[model samples]
Target: MEIRNAKETIRQGAPSDESSKPDHTTKMIVYMTIASTAAEGLTGICSVVSSFLNDFSME
Candidate 1:
């Protein structure tokens, strides 16, 4: 039927339409910023724990 053919055409076109989406540069930048912030936070936690352990060991 014509309707079935049209439906198949529409279905095949859907993925190409979705693939033509724009880049998410802004979202990527935001994610990178968040990842950097998390890394800094983890570094601070490690430093603090090391310092505490050193002080306790000296006592």
Candidate 2:
């Protein structure tokens, strides 16, 4: 009986551990995606501002 209970506990715990691993990975991917998007937006804004300044200086 005790061995059976132990086996059941291990089976349940294994799935929980596997599920948690994917949750962590998903969170990391979401964070990285947000960071990359923000970086791209900032770069685009900088480029536009630089072009505007260059045009202003030429006039």
Candidate 3:
């Protein structure tokens, strides 16, 4: 059916649309996202460790 063909066309076009972005910019975005996520996770771990240390110190 025509609707099915149209859906297929849209699916094929999606990757091209995404690929149109500059590769450097995409890499920067991905790297920044990874870096920020890692930093946030580390911060949370440090906070928990600090809290535990503080509790031990209070005893």
Candidate 4:
């Protein structure tokens, strides 16, 4: 009886493991996209600040 219960648990766990793989991949992709977008925004802000400083120094 214990062996039968264990088998049932394993069978349930198997489908969850398979489903989690794609969910994990999707979460990783989303994180990467957010990181890249933040990097682009930071670079744009840095360039604008540098240009402004250059103009101020020239004056």
Candidate 5:
């Protein structure tokens, strides 16, 4: 019957929705971590470059 099939489909899809939530959360966390690390590396490089330039200019 149509009603019985609808219930079966809903049951089948429940686990899939639950599984996707964790996957999205993990992906977001990984992206944020990578972004922060890249920012730190860039900041360090800029600081070094600025200091080097200042030293060179003084000479």
Candidate 6:
């Protein structure tokens, strides 16, 4: 009975320690996604501005 309790306690403790660890891969993925989104937004804005200026200059 005591051995079972000890095993249960150890198992619970193990998960808490594992959960506390920062997953670098997940962080990297999130960072990459944010960077890609920002880059796409900037590119889209630049394209719009360039087209607007071209149209204005032609008018």
Point to the candidate with the largest lDDT: 1
Per-residue lDDT tens digits for candidate 1, residues 1-59, read 99999899998885666578988999999999999999999999999999999999997
Q: Which segments of model 6 are wrong by more than 4 Å?
A: 6-12, 15-21
lDDT of 4 by residue, 1-59 (tens): 99999899998776665676655777899999999999999999999999999999997
Alpha-carbon lDDT, every model: 0.93, 0.89, 0.91, 0.89, 0.90, 0.92
Each model's TM-score, in the order given?
0.56, 0.60, 0.51, 0.57, 0.58, 0.65
- Which candidate's TM-score is highest? 6
lDDT of 6 by residue, 1-59 (tens): 99999899998885676789877998899999999999999999999999999999997
Candidate 3 per-residue lDDT over residues 1-59, each given as its tens digit: 99999899998875676678666977899999999999999999999999999999999
Q: List the lowest-lDDT window of 10 residues for candidate 6.
A: 14-23
Which is the better candidate, 3 or 4, if ranked by TM-score? 4
Per-residue lDDT value at 31 in model 6: 97
Q: Return model 5's CA RMSD, one decimal.
A: 4.9
lDDT of 1 at 36: 100
For candidate 4, the C-alpha RMSD (Å) to the true structure equals 4.7
* Number of clashing residue pairs, candidate 1: 0
Off by over 4 Å in 4: 1-22
Worst 10 residues of 3 by lDDT: 14-23
Over 4 Å off, model 5: 1-17, 20-22
Worst 10 residues of 1 by lDDT: 11-20
Q: What is the Å distance of residue 12 in model 3 from its true position?
A: 18
**Number of clashing pairs, model 6?**
0
Task: Put down candidate 2 lDDT per residue, 1-59, tens digits, no spaces.
Answer: 99999899998775565666645777899999999999999999999999999999999
